[model samples]
Target: MSTHRALRATVVAVAFGATGLLGAGVASAHVTADIYGSEPQKGGSGAIVLRVPNEEADAGTTKVEIDFKPEYALSSVRYKPVPGWTAEVTKTQLPAPVKNGKNLDVTNPVTKIVFTAQPGSGIAKGDAEYQDFEITASTLPSTVDELVLPAIQTYDNGQVVSWDQVSTGGAEPEHPAPTVKLAAASAGGDDHAAMASGSGESGSGGSSGTDDTARWLGGAGLIVGALGLGVGGGAVLRSRKAGKSNA
Candidate 1:
């Protein structure tokens, strides 16, 4: 191949490669939910952490809303206080009374939870900036293997992103909703007490590990992107010099 053709090909490849890396970084920065420590067993109480990332270049995340399916029939819901955020829990009357973990009938079940940032406080605008919001359920529904929590994120600039699509045929959707998979119900013994104590002891460590890994990956992506740009620039410079010499 001629010198000019080789240089043009190099630049094109570098540009496309860099763009793909950057796109992957942005695509992975979506809201996710996971068990705090040990997976919660069916019909047992456990804590769940919702990791919300700020993806907008010019706007910070100002509010988040998570909707619980009525099938969950959750009897009690509680949230940990975040310094710069306020949490609101909403409940609605169920069509029929359902039996709770305690064997008592529940008429109203929690349907939604909303978190709003206080004045001047929000998840700062960046791909790496995020906040983990936690909520503990008094009892988990036993009928399903996983809980799907659809979320809506509102930005400071009034842009809203909805994470509500459910995967079909094992294929993930563009804006897949967050989910928490439950473990099989415990055989007997005091499962609730065990889960609470275990999570309390190990929750912070688990969360920290996850955050650290995420930061490392983000840093790596940035480095790769920078290198791609440098290579592309160098190739263009060489191409221009060759053209001048050929003239």
Candidate 2:
């Protein structure tokens, strides 16, 4: 092949390979608790999104139950309404109220949350359609590095999958619970100023920036792959035309 032809073929191969990999990644992206706040204050409220995707080739997801360990010591919890699903919050009496300062008191907070897809409201079994269950978990307890939310995913066919496996620190569990790494909530760490100023939108933007980085990377990979295929196809066409002219 000519120099130009070789370059085109290389681009085609790499781009297609990249595109394939990214596509696979999207398919395999499992249920996750995407924490918006990078460093959830030990005693502050934080929002998290539980992204649930239907991995079933044919079955639609119908219900999802997330259990918060009694040990986590969360003070308050609130669930956002999903258009096609009904959310239920279950609160249990804490051993004691989580008192912050002299005025703020959070008691009898949420211990469990369940979302049931109303008829066809479940995550549609498809290439990219999924559901996000957003919730606000408040007054995160201190002295923890990560928060693991064990989730049970149910499909329309009555099949149940548990994301309950945990690891001390070694080989990853086959079914890993959705977890969030906690950062120190200090003056420079947590968005204290942002929280106080009630400029939640800016703080939210900053928080989501970190969570979305990985997704952004995957999307970029897909775009690059497509471009590669285009370049390669052009190169092959050019090479064939040159050969015909020389013949």
Candidate 3:
């Protein structure tokens, strides 16, 4: 083929590839979490499993960090061990004291946990791993209806994926971070009760998140279709011009 034709073909190919990529990125772009079996009952003890995904393309996931909400005010916290990884749990002091009760002296503390993946645990390119961490705690706050676990995923190349975007009732921000939600409080529980309820729903149905992802992929496919048609049209036009020139 002529140089001009070859270049046109390449342009079309690139556009088509870009469309597919855009869709794939949207489909796979969230730091998702799951609370294993059930939501922690108000003022009760329970076990939770957090699922975190690696977002970096070039590097493998090296570390995962999670910060617990002060509302939980968990007296005890623990983690389940995983193969090929090292886990560390730290209890952080609050900047200002939070009132637990008239006689109860309590402060807003944080649980900062980090997980370092083994050398081979660095997930390969175009792949991801769902790391589950089992956390145990007791006597949660009733007002602390929702447990928001904002996590940061770090890769071997120092790329950090921060999943801290919190959603309000409406009007989401651009490039918002992803967040793992805990069960909200019950109707009579408190305002925070609603938060826990919502979290409980998410925990039970893992498929909802996947649906949102599928929509993003569909959008990407549409873009690819448009680009493919444009490239094909260009090719036809060139062929017509060549035929006329020969005639």
> Number of the top candidate by lDDT?
1
Candidate lDDT scores, in order, read 0.75, 0.69, 0.57
> Candidate 2 on 1-247: residue-level lDDT in tens?
4766676667767666766755542334677887542556665566677888888888888999998866666655666677778877787877666543223555665678899989656787764677877776756666577788999999988889999788769988888898876666676544421221222122333443444566668768667766866676777778899999999
Question: Each model's TM-score?
Answer: 0.65, 0.62, 0.54
In order of TM-score, best first, we have 1, 2, 3
Model 3 scores a TM of 0.54
Cα RMSD to the true fold for all candidates: 10.0, 6.5, 11.7
Q: For residues 1-247, what per-residue lDDT tens digits would candidate 1 score against the true structure?
A: 4765676666567666656754442334679986534677788776777889999989999999999886687876677678889888898997798876546677898889999999999899878688878777757787788889999999999999999998876867888999988888767721432222223123323333454356568756766766776677677878888999999
Candidate 3 Cα misplacement greater than 4 A, ranges? 1-29, 95-104, 171-247
For candidate 1, the lDDT comes to 0.75
Task: Tell me which residue pairs clash in candidate 2.
Answer: none
lDDT of 3: 0.57
